[model samples]
Target: MVIYVFDGSFEGFLTAIYESYYNKEKPDKIVAMDDYVENLIDRPIFIETDEIKSDKVYAGIKNKISTNALKKVYHVFLSEVMEAPTVIYHYLRLGFKIGNKVDLNLMDDWVLRMDKINQQVASEKHRMLGLLRFQLVENDLYYAPLAPDHNIIALMANHFAQRMSDQKWMIHDTKRCIAVVYDLKEWIITPIDLPAPPVGKEEYLYQQLWKEYYQSIAIKERRNPRLQKRCMPVRYWSFLTEKK
Candidate 1:
C-alpha cells in the first residue's frame, strides 16, 4: 500500500493531490504527518505543502469544475473526519473528470461521502449560530465558548461579524483550541488557552434575568424532552446560559 502523508493542512492536502497527478501514481491512503508511522509493508511518501502546487490545483478546480465544487472540497476539509484527505482526493478526481456534474452523481461513493462531510460541517455551523451564548467580560468583549464536533469557528465567525459589526466578540472552540476574535472591525483566528473568566456584574445580572425569563416562559404541561432534544441537541445545553 502506498500512503501519502502531509502536514494536516488543507493546502498540504491539495499539494498531495497535485503530487498524485504529477507522478501518475495514486496513493492507497492520504494522511496527516502526525498520523503516519513507518510500516514495512506500506510505502510512505511525505508531501510538503507547496503554495504554487496548491494554487494550481485550486485554480483548476475553479476553472474546470464549478466554484461551488471548490467550496464543497473546503467544507469537507473543515469536517476533519477520518480519511478526509483520501475522500477529498477521490472526490476531486471525479469532479475534475465529470466537471460540475459530479455533484449530481450521488450514487458515487466518494461523492456521497464528501457530501455527508460537508453537511456535517454545515449542520454544526448552523447549530452554533443559535446555541452560542456570550458573556460580557471586563474588556467589553462578548466571550462565548463551544466544543463542536467539526472545525466550524471560521464558518460561524463571518455570520456573527456581520450581525454584530459594532461590538467586539470572541468565539472560542475548545475542541480545536482555537478562537475567532473580532475587534469591531476585523476578525483574527488564533490559539487561546485561558479558562472561563469572571463576567462583569451587569453581565451576571443579565444572565440571571435571562435564566428567569426562560423559567417563566416554560409551562410544565407543555414540556417535552424528546421534542426539545429534536429542536436543540442535548450536547449544546452545557454552553447555554439558561441551561447552566
Candidate 2:
C-alpha cells in the first residue's frame, strides 16, 4: 500500500488531492506528517503543501462545482473524523465527475457518507452557538472556553463577530488549543497558549446570581435528570456556570 503524508492542514490536504490527480496515482492512505509511524513494508510518499497547487484545487472546485458543494467540502473537513481526508478524496473525485450534481447523488456511498459527516459538524456548530458561556476576565476581555469534539471554532467566528460586533472577546476551544478572537471589528483564529486570567469579582458575583436564579426557578417536584440530559447532554455541563 502507498501512503501519502501531508502537513495536517486543510490546505495541505487540498494540495495532496491535487498531487494525486496530477500524478495520476491514488494513494491507499493519506496521513499527517506527525502521525505517521514508519512501516517498512509500505511505500511512504511525503507531500509538501504547495500553495499554487492548493489554489488550483480550490479554484477548480469552485468553478466546476456549485459554491454550496465547496461549503459541504469545508464542513466535512471540520468534522475532524479520522477518515475525513480519505472521505473527502472520494467525495471530490465524484464531484469532479458529476459536476454540481454530485450532492444530488444520494445513492452514491461517498455522497451519503459525506453528507452525514457534514451534518455532524453543522450540528455541533449550532449547539455551540447556544451552549457557549462567557465570563468577564481581567482586562475586560470576555472569555469563553469550549471542548467541542470537532475543529469548529473557526466555523463559529462569523456569527459571534456580528453578534458582538462592538465587544472584544475570545472563544477558546481547549480541545484543539485554538481560539477565535474578535477585536470589535474583525476576527481571527490563532493558537492559544495564554493562561486563563482571573475572573473579576463583579463577574463572579453575577455568575453566582445567575446560578441562584436558575436554581430558584426550578421545580424540585418536576426534576428529571434523564430529561435534562437528553435536552442538554451532560458533557457540556462542565462549561456551563450553573451546572459547574
Candidate 3:
C-alpha cells in the first residue's frame, strides 16, 4: 500500500495527485504531511508541493471531475480543519469509484462528515461578508482586518469586489497572513504588511456622523443588550462601524 503524504495545503493535495499519477501508483491513503504516521507502510511517498506539480494535478482533476466537484473540494479545504484532508481524500477516492455520480447523497459516513464541514465553512464565509468593514488609508486604498475561523478570505473576495468595485480595497485575513486586494481593474490575492491610513479631519468627521446616526436609532426603552449579543456577539463588534 502506498501512503501519500502531502504538505498541509490545497496546492499540496493537488501536487500529491501529480506524484501518484507520475509514479503510476494508486495511493492507499493521502494525508496531510503532519498527519502521516510511520506505521510500517509497504510504500510511502512524501510529496513536497511544487507549483508545476500543483498545476498539473489541478488541471487533471478539473478535466476528470466536473466543475461542481472541484468547487465542493475547495469549500471543504477552506475549513482548515484537521480532519478535512482525510475527508477530501475519501471524497476523491469515492469520485474514482462512482465517477460523477459520487456527488449524490448516500448513506456514507465520510460523505456526510465532509458535507457538514463544508456547510460550516460556507456559513462562516457568509457571516464575514456582512461583518467586514474597511478603513481608507493615505493612498486611497481601503483596508480592513479580520480573523475568521476558516480560510474564507478567498471565498469572500468575489462578493466585495462586485459590491465595492471601482474602489481600491484590501481585506486582510490576519490569521492567514494574507489579503485580497481589489484594484480598479481586477482583484489580486496578496500578502500583507498593512500600514494604517493617515487620519484626516474629514475622515474623523465622517466616523462621528456614522456614530451619531447609530446613536439616533437607539430606543432606550426597547433595547435588549442580551438579545442583541446573541445575534452579533460582543467579541465581533469592535471593528463594526457603529460599535466602539
- Deviating ranges (above 4 Å) for candidate 2: none
Candidate lDDT (C-alpha), each: 0.90, 0.88, 0.79
Ranking, TM-score, top scorer first: 1, 2, 3
TM-scores of the models, in the given order?
A: 0.96, 0.94, 0.81
Candidate 2 local distance difference test against the native = 0.88
Error of 1 at 114 (Å): 1.2
Better of 1 and 2 by lDDT: 1
lDDT tens per residue, model 3, 1-244: 7888887878998887667666777787777877767877457788888998888756755667667778888898778787687687777767766777776856788888878888989887878888897876667878788888888888988898888888898888877789988888778888887644566666678789988998999898899988988877777787787896
Model 2, position 63: C-alpha lDDT score: 96
Clashes of 3: 0
The runs of at least 3 residues in candidate 3 whose Cα sits more than 4 Å from the true structure, single-residue gaps closed, are 1-4, 18-45, 50-53, 218-222
Model 3 steric clash pairs: none
TM-score for model 2? Answer: 0.94
Which digits, one per residue and each the tens of the lDDT, describe model 1 over residues 41-126? 99888898999999999999999999999998998888888688889899988988989899999899999999888988988889
Candidate 1: regions farther than 4 A off: none
